[model samples]
Target: MHLPNGIFMLQRVQTVYMIVAMLCIGALYLWFPSVEDAAGIAVIERSEPLVFGLIFASIALAVISILTYKKRQLQFVLNRLNIILNFVLLGVFVYRSLTLSGETLVSEKGIGVLLPIISIVFLVLANKAIKRDEDLVKSVDRLR
Candidate 1:
């Protein structure tokens, strides 16, 4: 299959950052339970519909951002949207963690709860790189 010229090229740093962010979210599906009960049952796992949807949506956005490499401005905008979506996901995790009783059913909050923050950091870095690329292109155009 003949792919487009620039699509899927790993030449840019932003693409790597975005892929890492996507992987971080995807990792939640493995063994990272968001919350566990005293009985060792997963109180909140990636299988939960809401959590699943949010995670999938974030991943989709990252993929789309990566694919739109030719349009730097659009790619940058998509990254911003992805960042906002991650913030919403983080908010949901925080709210859920806060609502669960700490002493009783809520035994421990898993490291999965921090995945959104990690994803957000990568997204921010990706955006910075995208912006830098855009500025470089603009400066080149100015020289002409």
Candidate 2:
């Protein structure tokens, strides 16, 4: 389908993937308590500056990548950066969960902690689609 500027095609698979990744990252905001103590006190949450910045950055990257659909290489690179950012966020979650008192049981962890993994998965899928598009373009150029 055509866009106003003749760019930003919504029919692209990578665009859909990036949008899903953005939504996954955005979902963390809905899960207030990223971690809770045995007594149910919130230990870490999306409101924390570090966590907020990381999530916001991830979402921003997804949006940028989606908008840059015409530039497949840039979109791929942005997805890679987003994946790395998600990894850092995951590490932060793991570290926080591990440091909690009394062995960090699964019950103490919140759904928010898993959002990064989901986002990362979508980002990887988007990157793969972008790479495929890039390769297709290259083959077409070669055939010229």
Number of the top TM-score candidate: 1
- Candidate 1 residues 32-127, lDDT tens each? 888887787786666778888888899999999998888888988898888998888888888887787665554687888888899999999999
- Which residue runs does candidate 2 get wrong by more than 4 Å? 1-8, 102-107
Report lDDT (CA) for all predictions.
0.86, 0.84
Question: For residues 27-102, what per-residue lDDT tens digits would candidate 2 score against the true structure?
Answer: 8876546788777778775578888899889999999988887788888889999999999999999898888766
Indicate which candidate wins on lDDT: 1
Q: Backbone clash tally for model 1?
A: 0
Candidate 1: what lDDT? 0.86
Each prediction's TM-score versus the true structure: 0.90, 0.88
- Judged by whole-model lDDT over C-alpha atoms, candidate 2 comes out at 0.84
Q: What TM-score, to 2 decimals, does candidate 1 have?
A: 0.90
